[model samples]
Target: MKYKVCGRLGKNLKAGWLALVLSVLPAFVVADEPPEDPAHAHDPANVWFIGRGGQLYDSWMATTMAEKPWGNHPAYPAIGNKRGYPTWRCKECHGWDYKGKDGAYRYGAHRTDIKGVRGVLGMEPAEIQKIIMNETHAFTEDQLPHSAVEMLSYFLSFEQIDMDKYIDRRTKKALGDFDEGAHAYQSVCALCHGYDGKKINFASQKYPSYVGSVCARNPWQALHKIRYGQPGTGMVALSNVDLGIVVDILSYCQTLPEE
Candidate 1:
């Protein structure tokens, strides 16, 4: 679908997160925040907790460079369809929407009765960290280091967004300002992604997953990568910026060349 600034999201449909996030940005340029010194984690610019945390959620194996777990996850149901490494991914059971059976994975091949991570949206990071290391989750010290778990917990506590609040579940469209979106992309993303967003092919030679292609297909996943840097790749992140700016970037991305 062709991207438009004032499309299906409607002028009256501005999300509160957009305004809320913009408030945190330094003159609307989140990337221009404080220097990369050994700063605190809460600092938006220094923080990779959100990005790396979410990346670990997407695939701990890739982000940690750890071996992908073989066979089904112990918690994964026997009735589920997938096998091997993929089943161990947090998104496999909980879903890209973080709403597991209750969300987009409710009825697909990825479907499982397992609940989503949304339950811990506002919980303390320490509490969530325990849950990750708990027997039910069964992540041992050897598998996931303390730092990795801490980052993942921080992401669960403060960084996760209610994607439904931003993108239309049906149309997968986002509300954004054209000029703002263009400026945001050119100022930051264009350096790596290049103008037209064709600098990289993330998927494969046959499918050719370019920036536009990803946004076009599974925008929820695209938004996740946009907010949190790509798994194990130094892809720039807007994890600390508000959801509005990122969605604006996404709306612009939808217009890129998919091939």
Candidate 2:
């Protein structure tokens, strides 16, 4: 039976069977080994880390689980206080567009006359880290872990997008298809923000800040959040999706009630 299985005459059967066995051996060995995880699963080279870094930049205090800096920032006197953790937010001074005084916050309640980090683009990540820890910035390693700082640096260095391309800063309108955006919003955003995007009151009722308010008032910030998600929240980042979808969602959100 073994000789017949080898498909050879009696004398050559052993050699033929040996050749067959040798050829098939590697297959069994490969099958015994566990399969590797998907390439997207926790890959160090994945751009998702950059998105997380963007989230950290949006609200380091929230991302790092660190206490907000006590009192106002040294430069806060010129900017006025709005109270709460927002005062300590990096975007509070830098502006969501990263244009700081040169951009959206140039003359708003968030104005601080501070230069944006736009100049810092393409800078060495290490240099950005040093600036973050510098006395002027005064971010302590204790407050923000090295990893978190590195992530923030990565975001500033690589993930800062040009809002001018996707939004009309003057009109505060998203440059996307409204119907497409509405569909995207109803699919996922409506779960927390509601069909009208007013289910969640990110700000006080008197102030009446909602998704629409954010989209209309600070489109840059809204775009950043939509791309990277809010820190320390269940809000999912849409970084992996086509950015046009994000712009579309922003357009739909703009149609919601702002006040």
Candidate 3:
């Protein structure tokens, strides 16, 4: 009689364990719920805003800190060396692509070693704009005008671009070609850079050499300058020119002497 009871009890125990497992099945099913997609994902409206913002920022960078570093105003000092608004241009730090030193300046003197905002894709817009106004980003809260700050912040908050894929380091060549680039340069850059592509003394005490100096040293920088127009100086953006024209200009400029 005892032996018979043991066999029956074992079967009952197995059945009880199975029932317990089945009872919690709903929890396991719920745990498998899908994870949330990135905040920027799938929404074309958001994409448009971010893209437009990015273009504006890049265009502004092209104007302010692009290659010249001292655009629109002759009196302004170098970006990193200066202590004012002209230096506060975003291109001075985060770069045209918003990648900062992590981007175009990864190895140059301007290199900041900072990460890109593109990395923080899901961050709140306010938080992103704050970063731009912060010392770590633009670093000119006091210098920047309220309207400038607000407008720049609005663009920065929405603008986000991944530039790592676009720029190349080894060849020092930007994303585009340098052949057609010559045409655009001739139209605008030729005046300053010169016909020989050996004009402008970027290193001189008074002015910078536009020739091969900047392009050879920093292609991405050259691209930014060409696209955005040097900050604090009279250099305005030639966005109308094809980016390929920029590359050609750089390629041709490289033939000039570094000294």
Candidate 4:
């Protein structure tokens, strides 16, 4: 009887020790989690780095909540439509397609006629950082912290996708299964975008551009937003999911309301 009691006590102690170890492990394991503050949430995960980097590349001001610069960037050409805050964005000059003059933004309100950053795709991050910090680019430390720049460099180096492969630039259609995409969207996206995806009107009540309009007009931009999230918004980046799934979501979004 005493031996059985001791055996039971041994099992209890073992279980108790296991529980204690399990409780303490998460704190150590999750130490690398991004901070609660949005500005400081530079995640270390490879996919998260890509997401944050993409957001920063999209709009550093929106990503870091940094104050807008006073005037047009010194490097910004007089021919460029974007001035001041907008010009500061990496994409303003480079194009969402990452091809700059060679890609989608070659001629539009967003055009700068500048060469895109696609050349830097396989380049070293340090070299890219130097280019961003140099006099030609001239991004100041106050406007963008080194950490933020690191994210940008990481993104520019690794995050760009050949959007043309997945989207038909002419027809502006996604090369994905609408039926499979519907399931993914209804399950994952409907919470914010709604069943019809008219929950948020991006343009305004008059024009009333919703997910469909944006996706149809610019599937490349929409895919980027889907994978990295919208800046200054609570939109969650779908980085951890499969690329196929992301494209599928884009296909479904294309079917939503435009106006």
**Candidate that scores best on TM-score:** 4
Q: Which portions of model 3 miss their true places by more than 4 Å?
A: 1-97, 104-112, 120-127, 134-142, 154-166, 205-208, 240-244
Tens-digit lDDT track for model 3 on 54-147? 3335444443233333333332224444353334445655665567656665655555565555554545556656765665443343344344
Model 2 clash pairs? none
- Pick out the ten consecutive residues of candidate 4 with the lowest summed lDDT: 32-41
Residue 238, candidate 2: C-alpha displacement in angstroms: 1.3
What is the C-alpha lDDT profile of model 1 across 70-138, one tens digit per residue? 777889897688988898788888888788877778776878889988888667778889999988777
Q: What TM-score, over all chains together, does every model reach?
A: 0.78, 0.77, 0.54, 0.80
Tens-digit lDDT string for candidate 4 (32-129): 33223333333456667667889988888998899988788887888887766788888888888788888888788887888988788656788889
Which candidate number has the best lDDT? 4
Q: Tell me the lDDT of candidate 2.
A: 0.79
| Best-first order by lDDT | 4, 2, 1, 3
lDDT of each: 0.79, 0.79, 0.53, 0.81
Candidate 2, after superposition: displacement of residue 213 in Å? 2.0
